[model samples]
Target: MSQRYHVVDRPDSRAPLDPRKLAQVLAQDGQLLLPMLDLIEHAEAAVDDLIDVMGRATIEAVLLMSAAGVAGPKQQGKRADRDVVYHGSQAGRVALKERQLRVTKPRLRKRAPQSGEPGEVEVPAYEAMRKDGRLADRMLEILIAGVSTRRYEHVLPEMAETVGVSKSEVSREAIEAGERLLKGLAERDLSGPDILAVWIDGIQLGPYHVICAVGVDADSHKHVLGLREGATENSAVATALLEDLVRRGLDPERRRLFIIDGAKALRAAIDRVFGADQPVQRCRNHKLRNVTGHLPKDQHEQAKATLRAAFKLDAKEGMAKLEQYASWLEHQWPDAAGSLREGLEEMFTINRLGLPSLLRRCLGTTNLIDNGHSAARDRMRRVRNWQSGSMALRWTAAAFDAASKGFRRIIGYEHIWMLKAALEEPAKDRSLVQQAVAG
Candidate 1:
């Protein structure tokens, strides 16, 4: 037996001894992992708190000592006890962090996480969680939450105790803290997404560009990449947006469907960025309005019904119903039937396969993004009209970040898979279609 390394059969300093002689520890204690992360986190928060306290305390001490008779040269010469206390506290913090760093040992991490040999290696599970890139996400949530959400109450009226930067020094500190988090998210190497679809479109925020990327995540739930400010909804920005999505951990190969409303810039951008073959679908409900606009008031309801039939979760039956409705419209309402005859059918382009909940929700007209947009608009509506484009965009983005905190992205995995595939091309699957009975 080597004296340098033992099986830990005898209890060690990390875990208690003499409790169970038969079982050696399977891994280093995971409980320590959280504490380790917290240790560094608290060290930082402590530094911030100290700065605030020292600033206020030093100001108070100076005023008090001056009132008591210390003035001019004497006041300058008399060093307040507050300075000594502040330095002492800071020194303690330095000592505390040094102790924590000893145990964190982030540098000890393996060069190769997997050796490819199948034997099990003892690893602390909690450490493994952050080791596999989850640390970035966890840290992102923490940092973004701080500046981007509740913490920003200092910047505006609605939310927090810290209202208005109140002072220039506080403003600088808050801004610096926010930039640190945003810079990390913006610069990190985002890879390995296995993306199944990409939702690209320039959303309206008063008059500014609010291009966004929405799509399914690893667990197959939809995630909103973010709202880009000032970036044109044109081909250049959309292309850059695609590349950004890739950096934000989206994989292009896994994504096949591109859903958007028919904005000329958005369409051109997607094509210029993603190329012509990228499977695209116009929002179904949005198209129906155009379709019905051509109809007589009396026929609008009938036309809507006909259009809705095509969106049935069943492909074959919907197609047959669509044909019957088209025939009725073309023959009976010739004056209003031309647009439907020419392009309304294309709206059904992705619905012919079994509807994926994502496609189904998207195809029917109102995209889930539309809902978020609506929420933003409701807030902006209070302003009557925004004073400037930046004002509108900022309010909208902040509103979304605040409101979407509770928005649970529906992945509709099974639906998204079929919807993505069906969007690829469905003429081949046309023959596999049978009349689907309504549930």
Candidate 2:
């Protein structure tokens, strides 16, 4: 073999490694060095490897900083000046975003001022990390996004020795988070927002039924106001929901256009809670469905078109056309005719107020709250069981919370001011009438 030349054998002119010099260099050019270091580390690494490396490095840096805060600067020799002493380090788990991380937590002790006895001191960062509120929130989001508790781990980033991702753990976190969200929604103060209209409807989840109230503010923003668990959407449940809203500062005396799916119980509840004078608009869609359900398949299109045409006319003309249709259906489809005649004038509430077609289309029915209910259903579709009323309520609240994130201003929002003006017109007329009588 030929003689080998080693570079290490040559005398090197570079100075010995100096901690002080290294610190100065890092302090002066740390920002510039990061890109170079990244290039060297990731130059040959795969994308996934690069991500893992960066994530672990970031986590390690955070843990190191936390350790330093607790233990202070390391001493080369014994120093009695420091009050806090490093006792040791132990394996600890912390929740970082949605993931639980295993870290070597530095333990510390402090000498009691009075007793001179060393007492264990908890690290603030560790204490904060130990609280997995964010993890619970993430669990709620993932569950609502249609991931089952059993398969939750598959959706998360792979890690070594990951903890707190079991099905039971996920369920526990989800329940806790769901309860918090439910409580938040139930206790939210409605007095602050300038709510212009209210839509009330019911949704059936398994054997349980819940009456939900959604409010629209003057700015056309929607708020999931309240819900009450019931066996059916009866007057009692609807009344309780409405009374709860009033108690939560919905202003019972304030005139608001009430939209409902032609549920007499809901209408009665509104009358009882906010007075019958509150303008009520029955959902045309619900009416059409009820009517068509009574008629034959062949007559469905004609009845629907006629009813829709009736809705576009002036209040007097619309009511006349609807009455004529009801008469035409009286002999064969009395139920369909009755459905058309029921709450007929309420269907024209927007038309009577002379609102623009935009506002008419938006406020004419319970479509706004119906859309929200659809969103809630979509989020909860993955859930197969409903154990209790409380559980149903919790899941509903969580689903609504997730769905509310994507809510946009109602279509024809620019003319929402007109609806507000129309809602107040009756009150204004009543006030004028009272003044005139007094005068």
- lDDT tens digits, residues 214-278, model 2? 88899999998987897324888888889999999999989888888888888888899999888
Q: CA shift at 351, candidate 2, in angstroms?
A: 1.0
Model 2 misplacement above 4 A? 1-53, 74-88, 107-121, 426-439
Candidate 1, position 337, lDDT? 58
Clash numbers, per candidate: 4, 0
Candidate 1 lDDT over 1-439, as tens digits, reads 6577555554556773431121112112223223333442333223222224332222222222222221111234455543111111010001110011111111112223456643222222223222232222322233233343334334332311122322343334434443443454355454644455556555565556677555654446655565555444365666676667665665554426666765556667666555665656677666677667777788778777767756763545665676667677787666455655554434554664456546466544436677777665664453444456545445555555555676774545445556555545554454345233222
Model 1 lDDT, full chain set: 0.46
Pairs with steric clashes in candidate 2 = none
State the C-alpha lDDT per candidate: 0.46, 0.76
Candidate 1 Cα outliers beyond 4 Å, as residue runs:
1-190, 226-240, 246-249, 313-346, 356-359, 362-366, 384-388, 411-439
